[model samples]
Target chain A: MANLTTKIGNLTLKNPVITASGTFGYGEEYLDFLDINQLGGICVKGTTLHRREGNPYPRMAETPSGMLNAVGLQNKGVDYFINTIYPRLKVFETAFIVNVSGSTLEDYIETAEKINSLSSIPAIELNISCPNVKQGGMAFGVDKDMAAEVVKEVRKVYHKTLIVKLSPNVTDIISIAEAVEHEGADAVSLINTLLGMAIDAETQKPLLSTITGGLSGPCVKPIALRMVWQVAHAVKIPVVGMGGISNARDAIEFFLAGATAIEVGTANFIDPAVSLQVIQGIDDYLQRHHCESIIDIIGALKTA
Target chain B: MKKFIGNLVVSENIPLKNNHFLLKLTQAEPLPLMLPGQFVQLKIDDTPSVFLRRTFSINYVDRLKNEIWLLIQVVGDGTRSLSKNKTGDSLNLIYPLGNSFSMPTATQSRLLLIGGGVGVAPLLFLGAILAEKGFSPSFLIGARNVDGLIELEEFQKFGNVYVTTEDGSAGEIGFVTNHSILKNTFDKIYTCGPTPMMQAVTQFAENKSIDSEVSLENKMACGIGACLCCVTQTHQGNQCVCTDGPVFNTKELVWQI
Candidate 1:
């Protein structure tokens, strides 16, 4: 009987378990395995104003307990999504949030404006924190000023809920979160993959073609939790927390740390049904604690 | 189209030359239709260090028996652990994943299938399917030595089989590209194996202006396309090897060769 409903600005998610962008492709790849309607929200792959070919061969490398990737936001541009992908996704009952990315401010505005025109897409997660791309990705996220500028311009064209994704590579994640909040961001999501690299000892060469790639998985949980706790305290808007969250227990930690909703990223690669399992686990935990609603536990951390 | 995660009982484990083992797995449910060049991701439950599932090309599929065969080479931690499995032991698999090899057109009758080492796994399935369609495809396989060669008898049942070994103990003394079989005019060629050997085959096919396809084996995490780890550069752009293809026409690939 516990209520899993949560709100981020004007948007109300059925549950707090949203599939992270890039991890879930337009929500079609997993349809055969599980029902897409069960998810609270599906954040489609990162899309740009123009088509992107992505990085070269060996785009990913497996680490100790994680993986590094430099896919560089590969997609067929926003036009194709609107014309082809949007129709297939419009029938889904769950919220469809577009993860918009660009190398320039105009690209962000154009893409966001296009997404705003699509009635089916309820929101857009502005990806200023993608570490794979060479130009605009982490560059805009690492600096508070660039992050604010992109959000401010996109805010003009994008009428839907605007969630700015924060980068962990920054020295002060709170500053970037506050900047986005000030620029009219409805919510903020953190932390996009930590920038890391791996080397093959035998060959003495970098494992990935893009020498340094974004590291994600269970290895990044602790760091992601700490940043979410800090940013959630600094900003008044809802905070969508994610990083190496594999199970429900991991997600509960994020809720307790003050995250309104949670996104499951790398775990999707490990188990496609992980998000559904997490949703079921949350319900079980709330019942076990005799809690009536998820809000009762959100940011309910006990610190001495 | 259906993906299953079930514990398959190992009905037979035949040890082959060069640390290779042919594992025959049987399940209670009916086996799904698996095509040539499609692979299965086997979860390594026994080993702790290897967390990711190991992928193997389907060597054979027997629908009536509800069984399938996996040709595994004990090269890494995952494969080495799989080799230790017994007949009664159970292993989990997510199967019938990735794109399959394209069947040759009716006009393209003369066909050649090439494989190097364990890369020969998918070729057996491809050869069998082609044979069933009334085409006898020639197979040219390469290995390091006589012991390195495997599954010759199963391959012979489909078509003319030729072998090349680094040591001169096999049918031909050099690499598959150097084998006498290459001199024959084949309308279509399919190859999978070491990168160098595949590239060589691709080059030879290009020289003769014949249609050719090559299967690539990239390191993969999810057998599905969710993880973009196993992407290969093609003439069109970068495509997921797990979803877009494990098999692609040589013309589609942008290899340096």
Candidate 2:
């Protein structure tokens, strides 16, 4: 039997299939379909300091082999998560990571501080790269200095595993990843949705209400794998690779490109059981190669 | 609500109109309790263009025979793929999702169920359950012309069926609102159809001071609440149509009408 266990900072996961934030709700919604505890980790929806109503109607548009979303971090705030959501999630056996988003540096620290106080939540994925939000999201992620500054501030308040999510909209994604790692980020996850827009031909108008939205799905996989490969080589911290991963074969590619763990995003909408299948596929690959542990395959890609 | 994911064998595929077909699927296991306004997500096969599951409201369900029926209108690639299904073929479905229409109470005997085009699908199930509950509800359906109408006999089995077509080829000569059935006061009104028709029904119900509910047809990805794509704005803010509801009380909706 192959050992699927892997470590991300201080945390140890049974597998490498964590449900991406924004796709998996608060972890309770999918409990009826599959065992939430079986997943490597569950990154709950992007939580903000204050309750947000999100963007207006027609926030999503379907693209070929992918989808565009401008859901502007619509969450009920950190207080609701602590007061109501946290208690309900405490019983889960797997790791529960909060994907924290904010408009300002103070909002990020405050949100991180509150989550740090929770004993059950072992990590928080700092969402400095959400492209849909109008104000702070992509702004910090695009610039190396801004990205490092946000991670530097949150690292002071957040005591647990800190993973900074990087945006693909930037020119030098590796620079931003290295900057955050230099500022005490325990781990890094990339790449957040690429910025793209669609137009309705008949109406001659933008498909999404926001005009432009973040694009995600199989369409963005090649770019995501390249970025993950580059960042893993540049930084010593663990890297979580995710972008358009739909099946086990797609996930194996991420591991080969150097991801300590993988997050299943839009694929959850296509198949809720995709993460479980991905875990099994990874185990099968390990067995076929006569490898005893998944660590043997991390960044195993051989190039000319 | 109980949710099931099973391979349902196609028992029958009855064509209703030029574009509509009634697909009856039976599972080996006993059918779970299903309510009106609830829907099932059907997985599309042999189509790379369509990746998401297609959501359809329950047209009818026969628990005794372990059968579930879906009224599919060939609109796009997804439904077009479903229309090609033959008897004995198996379909994977995730079912009994979303909330149901509010059942009429003992005092609220006079009920009105309205539908337009393919939107009349769920109303058949609603009318069937209401009839079984001892309420003889009236059903008003609208289409472009006589040929556009579907499953009139099935609807008639539960209540007095009234229909209106733009070309006067059916029961009445205008929109469903133009039908004389509006003259009779109903205790409660339930509707699902074109947005314009539903809005008209809501306005008529509002004028008569009658309680009204509507099921919206938003473009959805996951019929389960996991994907927050299918959202409807209500008095309480944005709610997932797949989970919070495909059905909502008219008073709760923030529609201008």
Candidate 3:
């Protein structure tokens, strides 16, 4: 059998098939569909220092082969998780890496510091790339200095693995990746939804309440793959690639392009058990290729 | 125990009045326990234009025969595409996704169920369950015209059915709110339909001091509450229509009553 275990920073994932932040919903939502402990990890919804109501209704709309969402990270605050949700999730066998986001440098550090105390949570996917919120997140993610500054500050109070998630709506993603790597980031994940918009021509209005929302799913796969291939080669730290990873074949392309692990996003809404299928499919591909482990295929893409 | 994702084989696709279709689906195993007023997230296959899963109320479930029914209205590309599904085609969906209607506390409590447009989908099941429990319930259905009326026979099986059409082509000859039956005393009311109609029903219930619940429909993605797209404001806060409810008590909703 092919070994499927992969590592992001020092945290060892059972497999490379983790659920994306907003897509997975604390891993409890999929309990009816699949076993939550089987995945490599699950990034629960984005948590901030305070509760967010998020955007108004019509926060999401379906584009061609993709979807746009402006959920704005509506969470009940990190304390709520630590109080009510964490007790339930702490016993899970898989890695419960919290995705922390905020509107200020203080918010990020404070949120990260709070998560640092949770023993069961192995890491925090620092979300400096949320495009939906009005402030902070995407602003920092698109800039190298701001990204590095936030990571460096959070690194002081946060003792666990610090994985910085990057935004794709930028001029030079490589600089941002290297900057975070320079600031002691354990690993980097890209590309957070591409910024896009959709309009209802019949109604003569924008489809989303926010007008512009994050574009994700298979439509953004090729662009995400290219960015991952570039950053995986450019940075020394591990790359956790995830844009439109719905199946194992799409996941394999990320591994070949040089992702140490991957996260499944919007596809979870379509099929609750997709991550499990992805894990099984990856193992099947490895056995078919006679590869002993996943490391053999990492960054092994052939280019003439 | 709550919900399951399954591929249901299309057993029958019965076209109804208007641009609606009654889709009967079954699987190899017995259908999961689904409550009346709960919904399903249907996955559209081979349709390039429709990318997201569409949400529908659990129109009816046949336990003995192991079948589920969906009342879909062809309002857009997604519904039109789903209407094209033929018998034996596999349709994947996540069922029993949201909360169900809470039954009345007192036995023989006067109950009225109002459904409009395709929102009438779930009331048939709710009325059937209420009748099974020995409660005498009444149904007031509204439509734009006679063509908009659907499944009158099915609803008649469980309750006294009342209807109104805007064009006066059906019962009462006006909106459902204009029906003469609203004068009668009732303990509680359950309604699902166009927002304006539901709002009117709620106001009437509030004025009568009768408890009422209304099911809301909104633009949704990931009908499991993770996406947070399908939300409605309430006294507590903004709640996801997909999870917290597609059914909410009239008093809890922020809409003016």
Candidate 4:
């Protein structure tokens, strides 16, 4: 078997395929379909400092090759996970990276401090890029200084690996990526859902309750690749790329674009075991190419 | 862990009343244990516009035959495409998702099941279950007109079947709430259908102070609890309809009666 190991900052993944936050729902949801430990890592749901009711019903709408979700980080708070959810998750050998999101700087810091104590958790994906929320999510991520500030504050209290998730809705994604890297972010995950909308033609009303939602699936793949490529070339920290990665072929495109690893987002909704197929598919590609390891293809995009 | 994703071959596709079709599926392996009001997330092939898997309530489960039945109404592209499935064509499914309807309490003997239009899908399964349990359930199914009323013979096999139509072309007319059957005292009520019809049933149950439950059909993406898309506000907070319930105690709902 060709070596599939890849690193994102200090965190080492058995493979380069990770299930995206909000899509995988703690790793327990897919137990019926595949072994959770087979994954490189699983980013749990986007959790907040306090319980959020999230948005109302009608939070999603289907579009061509994609879907829109305004499910604004509805979780039972970080303490609930650490107390009730974390114990169950501890049995899984795969990395369980909690996706941390907050409405304020203190919320982020407090949430990270609590998670920092959990030994099973290896990293925290600072969700500064969730576009569905009204505050603190995409707000801090779109601005370079605000992105740096949040990562800087969380970095102080969070004693483990901190991966800053970046928003693709921003005009200059590279600047935001570089800013977080300068502020002690160990690695960065790029292309959180691009903001989009859908309308019911007959009803002539917005399909989603929030009117606008983050777009994911195959439609956003090109834009995600562009941003990952731009950010990877700009920042020294390892880039964890994601957005519309449904299969291993899509994943290979990201690796060539300098993404050290890729996250499978909306694809999980279609097939719960898709991440495992991606893992197997990646291995098949490496062996077919006679490549010794996945690292050989990272940032190896042929410009000539 | 009991739920799974697998491909079940289409054994037969029998067209029903109108745009509706009874899709009977079978596999070499036994079908998973599905409940009366549970559902499946079916993956649509050849329809790219229908990006997400479409959710449908379990119409019936033929455990002895290792077959499952999904009563589909051609509402849009996703369902229409599914209706076109031929025998031997395989369909990917995530089965037995969401919670099922609750069984009757010891003191509760009288049973009422109200379903509307295609919403009557799951009640047939529930009616069969109730009959099997010796509950002798009564069904109050409604539709826009006579043609809209579906699966009467199937429901009849389980228990007494009653129906209402707006045009009065069928049984005792007006909405299902206006049917004379509601006048009878019932120990328990179960309903699934269009929101307005289910709401009417809920209003009746609440007014009588009788115990009742209604299955919700909120739009869903992930049939598992993962996607927060399908949620219903309850007294406890907003709970996911996919896992928390496709079936919920009418008492728990925050809806105004």
Best candidate, lDDT: 3
Q: Cα RMSDs of all predictions? A: 1.6, 1.1, 1.3, 1.0
In order, the Cα lDDT scores of the candidates are 0.90, 0.90, 0.92, 0.92
Cα lDDT tens digits, model 3, A1-304, are 6898898888999898889999989998889889989999999999999999998878888899999999999999999999999999988899999999999999999999999999999999999999999999899999889999999999999998999999999999999999999999999999899999999998999988899999999999999999999999999999999999999999999999999999999999888899999999999999999999999999999997
CAPRI tier of model 2: medium
Clashing pairs in 1: none
lDDT of 1 at A157: 94
Q: Which residue runs does candidate 4 get wrong by more than 4 Å?
A: none
Ranking by DockQ: 4, 3, 2, 1
Model 3: docking quality category? high
TM-scores, all models, native as reference: 0.97, 0.98, 0.98, 0.99
lDDT tens digits by residue: candidate 1, A1-304: 6899999989999999999998888778887667989999999999999999888878888776788888889899999999999999988999999999999988999999999999988899999999999889888999999999999999999998999999999889999999999999999998899999989999999988999999988899999999999999999999999999999999999999999999998888767778999999999999999998889889999997
Model 3 chain B: weakest 10-residue lDDT segment is B99-108
Where model 1 places Cα greater than 4 Å from the true spot, the runs are none
**Whole-structure CA lDDT of model 3:** 0.92
Instruction: Please list the residue runs of candidate 2 whose C-alpha ends up more than 4 Å from where it truly belongs after superposition.
Output: none
lDDT of 1: 0.90
**Which prediction has more favorable lDDT, 1 or 4?**
4
Give the CAPRI rating of model 4: high
lDDT of 4 by residue, B38-117 (tens): 99999998997889999989999888888899999999999889988899999999998988999999999999999999
Shift in Å, residue B47, candidate 2: 0.9
